[model samples]
Target: MTLASSSKPSANRKPTSYESLMAGVAAGAIEGAITYPTEFVKTRAQFSADAGGKRGVMSILTDTIKTRGISGLYSGSGAMIAGNGLKAGVRFLTYDSIKELLRDSNGKMTPGRTVLAGLAAGVVEATIAVTPSETIKTKLIQDASSLQPQYTNMVNGTIGICRTEGVMGIYRGLWPTIMKQGANSAVRFTSYAWIQGLMINFTQPPSGKLSSTMTFGAGAMAGLITVYTTMPLDNIKTRMQSTGASLKYRNSLDCLTKIIREEGVQRLWGGTTPRLARLMMSGGIVFAVYERLIGVMTSL
Candidate 1:
């Protein structure tokens, strides 16, 4: 059921901050766990220096399974699952808060306000949860691909990175993370709203809420838009967060320059396929689950 499907006006009531946070946490965890294999492949592709030829998603998946076993596809899933939940909670909380603040006297948020709220939420999540979690996740994936893995698990990897590289090691890709996340949420939220609005206008469901199918379709479209627009930033973020990033590239810009100069412009989209698949499903899963949870919570 969509948010607007309730017969009573109270059923359509906006979610409270706590509701948003909890719903987001559940939604994020579900999405992360379900789509993690694609995420693992995407990170590997992004960090790989295969200038001679780009590997397809299937190739990477088969290779990882062949060498490291099927479980290898989930190498850093622990960090991703935990981090996805936390960051999603923060994201929804911040976005809802800012959206409330930006609402007009009529309690409507314009597209610009929505974008701003999403951007703010993305930045907040990136700083608080995404950077560290992603850094560890990237390192773990990279480690798992090595001949002899250094870190055994998420906890051990976190401690190992800190012990050797200090606390900042876990925040290796701070700048690019912020940029990527900010743009990601902004584009996603804006596009989702726009597409959902169009769908609602066309369907005009009796309860005023879109069907689950429509909501998922709208979200998937938003994810598709987000993937192409933000792929380069994502590549840069992965590169900066990977092990030995400090030695390989000076900063985000330098990383961009080197990838283009050495690997060609198309290399910027190294992991587009896996990332696109994950995010397309991610958008649908996250919003659908969040909306369902919010519906349940608000009703109670």
Candidate 2:
């Protein structure tokens, strides 16, 4: 949820915790399912070259399809759907709850408060839900040195990880994930708020109803800004999560340092195109669906 601009008429209806939670689950699952192939492509791209020279996005996609078939692109989608559903549900629920608590006597949420709420939401999701999902998803997508698969599926992979690495193994990149998600939420909410304000002023829609087109466009822009701004952290998070041990780097800082020193700074932006592709639609779908769903639920 976003802070209503002065020019845009506020519905003044807050969704109940259940409504917000369900809407977030629906929106996040839809977004994840629709955009998962791109996510798979991106995860594969982020790792180091596999004895062959570095492959581009298309090569990775094509190789996955050829070797593993079309299903390869959806390797970790089950885990992703569950993970994203939980993450989004908790994030919106926490964000809205925090916003409600922080509202002024006028019953209005300020942009700053919204940002802080988003930060808290991101941290909560990262710590509780995202890290495990990301770890599993990355391992599933990463090409193994062996010809045979290490883990048969998400369930097996998760079990194997826990059995071998324990709980901490499943949460390998917790810090980077938290940092990435925190920055991601902060940038996304703040930029979307700023963009929404500008759009409301610019279009001046009658009755203050924002056009779906404008909302989607704004979401896309916000997604771009958030992804680009946090690409480095995301890259580090991905590497740390995908790597089983400290063969290459010991920690997040070491990962960052090694990536810059060994692979050059530009390596930090690996898989950006696929990530952008996934998130552009994901961002738009999430906000648009969420806003409409919440509105409908409120009216009911």
Candidate 3:
């Protein structure tokens, strides 16, 4: 899910860091729960290239449901829900803080500064939260796909990975995760801001708050842009975090090269369809919820 747009502070009061963090947590948790099935499908699709399967999104999704039941779609959801909440909270707190620092005398930050703030927030969240959780989630999902699943739940999965591969196992794809997250946030924030600016120019809400509908639309559009732009990095990150990734590929660069050489360049975007579906809805849900929650919290 994409971050909530960093709207201008309310005329009466700005939200405190706690308010932003709480709002982000709620928004992201809601988004993760709602869109996780699509994520399951997407991850499985990414693995199809290595398996030499020509399955499409619907095919994979249907197979998962038929073979593994509905719960299979939520195999790694615990890790994702937790990670999404924490990362989104950290992201909003860091982005808002950095954006505040970059604001000039007019209380406005240039687009470049906005991008820089988003990049910094992304790197921070990836380093602090995303990589380890995502690695665990990926492993769980991958294991669940097998005929005999190894890990039963998030806690067990973490313990199992650590027992087998050590602590670094859950941080396997650190560099690729950072790259994907950094670019993802930079593009998402910039595009969301630009879209909101255009909408504001057209509608000019008296309170400087776009309607919920407008905000959702803008966020979904931003999600669309981000998915296409960052899909390759996302694929690499997923591969790197998967089981046996270290033995198969040396690093993120090697993963990229091998995927291109063996699976074809288009394989880099292997999970684009399901990811696009999830993020489009995720961006809209997250931004709408976060903005509404922040508005309520700040007014309190």
Candidate number of the best TM-score: 3
Index of the highest-lDDT prediction: 3
State the TM-score for model 3: 0.96
Tens-digit per-residue lDDT, 80-187, candidate 2: 888988888887788788878887887766788878877988899899889989888887766342377787778988888888878788898899999998888878
Q: Order of candidates by lDDT, top first?
A: 3, 1, 2
Query: What local lDDT does model 2 show for residue 172?
Result: 85
Q: For residue 17, what is the lDDT in candidate 1?
A: 84
Question: Which segments of model 1 are wrong by more than 4 Å?
Answer: 1-10, 50-53
User: Is candidate 2 or 3 superior in lDDT?
Assistant: 3
Each prediction's RMSD to truth: 2.3, 2.1, 2.2
What overall lDDT goes with each candidate model?
A: 0.86, 0.80, 0.87
Worst 10 residues of 1 by lDDT: 1-10
> Each candidate's TM vs. the true structure?
0.95, 0.93, 0.96
* Candidate ranking (TM-score, best to worst): 3, 1, 2
Clashes of each: 0, 0, 0
Question: What is the C-alpha lDDT profile of model 1 across 1-300, one tens digit per residue?
Answer: 232211123345678888899999999999999999999999887766543556677888999999989899999899999999999999988988887788788766688888998899999999999999999999999899889999889999999999999999999999999999999999998888888777877886776666677778888999999999999999999988887779888889999998899998988888999899999999998888887788788777
Weakest 10 consecutive residues of candidate 2 by summed lDDT: 1-10
Cα lDDT, model 1, residue 58: 83
